[model samples]
Target: MVQSNHETIRMNPNIQEKPETLTKLFIRKFKKNKLAVLGAVVLLIIILSALLAPWIAPCNPGQTNLANKLAPPGADHWLGTDRFGRDVFSRLLYGGRISLLVGFGSVAGALVIGTTIGAVAGYCGGIIDAILMRFVDIVISIPSIFLLITIVAIFQPGVEKLIFILAITSWTTTARIVRGEFLSLRTREFVLASKTIGTRPSKIIFSHILPNAMGPIIVTATLLIGTVILTEAALSYLGLGVQPPTPSWGNMLEDAQNFTVLLKAPWYPAFPGLMILITVLCFNFVGDGLRDALDPKGNL
Candidate 1:
């Protein structure tokens, strides 16, 4: 027995036998996708610009300069002045802060609520699962955009309100995804072993099962951020979101609705629209990359 153990240790070098951590493995796999890497870079730049808006923005995003109203891109006013003569570039930077904040906040709220409900329903099974899934079905039946519009119209439109509405509406999908994951994971050997060893149900569900299920949850959350941003933009475009002087990309696009501005000053709307497109695309790319990286069958 001692010789067998010695032989095994000798055959498997200590350095080579060390297990790779999930984070490191994930990073390695993620780096193999070029588009995802590019997306990550662009996302980092956008986030940094939004976070540093106060210092980086040339002029006050809210301040108006009648003299410079409708000015095209120039040395003094990069990306030009808006109809109100506010710096387009400054507003763009400041606008990013609000857009990103709403997206992140809404998705985070949804993830928490969805994960908890999904875990309970899936782990408990039977009547609980049926009720929870039925509720999910009802919510899914409603047209989310219509619900959002009605809710926003009934209540005041503000950042906090928008985030709350989005969270309430968006969690259904996440719940479904997490429930499916839990249904499968609960039957796995590790989970069964934990239960057999007298681990508390709560501990087993959260500590063991949730971590294993996070691969899909994380990917879904990343994609959901893009979706929330688009929804916020749509609401703002309809004059029901973020309100003027707050300067989200959506409200900023409202200026383009004017035929005169659209004809004469194309740059006024172009920058914000481009930013929104790029932001959404980057998120999607990152999510796709994450899906591939996290999939067991994907190329390592």
Candidate 2:
């Protein structure tokens, strides 16, 4: 009778699992995504190359060796030289640093500010939420690019100023996202239990609520990096961002905008444009994979 009962317990279909930790589950899901893995590898290579640009580059990106002006790719000058005799490969690697910096740095700034505003508004509700959301609505009503152009025009263009403008303009989306998240999460049993336990509102919001909403925030942030890069590129292409002599992909294309150069010095436009494409594509793939991997619904 004892053996039969033991066997019955062992064979029970309702037996619970050893709960998989979040890290373990995340790793398992992430590893299953081949494209995401490839994206990670590519992104890593780009980042490493950017960090080591000075050492890896054969020629100085800014130095004008007039003798090598517009030189095509060769054994010495890999990926060729630009109109001003700057090494294309060197500038590309260095440019990646600035582009990626702006992309990430601006998003970080926006994320912090937006998350705070959204969390506060959602958690506090009533008048505070109305006032803050109204402000957000006002900001969102304006054309973001036009607003950015106006701001940039007033402040003058440089990395810091550009970051500021982008940060200010970019946060609206994050605010909306977090606000929705907070609204939903505030009603959950865990949140009610925390409140009932006399957990401070601030602690409850940051500790319990924010963590639950981090998935969408992270996914949005990954996607935002690509958008920021493209925005910076567009601004630079318009001659309003990252001034000349500072190697950037957008300005590289701007410099090569001449019809004559487009046909003659094809390398000028091609390489930088290719970099933008690859970087954007990689970020998008990574974002998609992250969304699927992190989904709590297990839909992926």
Candidate 3:
């Protein structure tokens, strides 16, 4: 038994060393970043609050008590009531659910479409690459927000519609980035070797190329979430996103835009704006950390 084990170890000496994956290595580096840890904690707290909103919210978010309109923060209403007497605190909690959902959902859709398009373009090369890249450029040349507004205008402003608009507009960036990465990687020795060895195209693209290209993809996806959230707020503010009585962060700002509400209930927009700022900032910080951590050459 001992002789057989020794022979196995001799056959593959590399087996004695620890095998660390990209995710494990990235995690190790991420743990060393203080700002990333703080950002992660803040994000976790927000996610938990969103998940537990029903149990934690003191009052009904959509329920209106006209008599208590514009009431200042106190024991009964921690964040106070808005113009419609809906609890600001509760609305903020519920609003986060929609905002975060849009951010994640749109980005997920973008990743799927972008990865597939980019991989095909890069791996196939020639006419296919030229055509796909031109399409990407055409999409990129147009103003994203304007395009989104135009599309959403046709569909009527709602959360699902807004998500679709953002997803369609957002995929261009992902495709551009992924295409660039794959373009550089496709000409490498390993890819050439895989081709020479008769490896399947799908296997070469996903099993080899995609794994190596994921670092930048992940970083971009993280940053895209922040962008998505900000875009959703902008759409909502323009009355082209989440509709009334829905209690989104953007429309919450709309409620506070009135002079009387600004003076009487400053907390309405203040809380929502603060939440947006902090959340976006955290995502940006996390993205930066991820970029530094995942750089294969340690060039951060």
Tens-digit lDDT track of model 3 for 264-285: 7676789999999999999998
- The lDDT of model 2 is 0.90
Residues 183-291, model 2: lDDT tens digits = 9999999999999999999999899999999998999999999999999999999999999899889898898898877776786789999999999989988888898
Candidate models: Cα lDDT each: 0.93, 0.90, 0.89
Q: How accurate is candidate 1 locally (lDDT)?
A: 0.93
Q: What TM-score number comes out for model 2?
A: 0.91
Model 3 reaches what TM-score against the true structure? 0.90
Model 3, position 99: C-alpha lDDT score: 92
**What are the per-residue Cα lDDT tens digits for candidate 1 across 145-251?**
99999999999799999999999889988999999999999999999999899999999989999999999999999999999999999999999889988999999
- lDDT sort, best first: 1, 2, 3
TM-score against truth, every candidate? 0.93, 0.91, 0.90
Residue 205: error of model 1 in Å? 1.6
- Candidate 3: list runs displaced more than 4 Å: 1-24
Candidate with more favorable, higher TM-score: 1 or 2: 1
Report how far residue 58 has shifted in candidate 1, in Å. 0.7
- Candidate 3 has which clashing residue pairs, if any? none
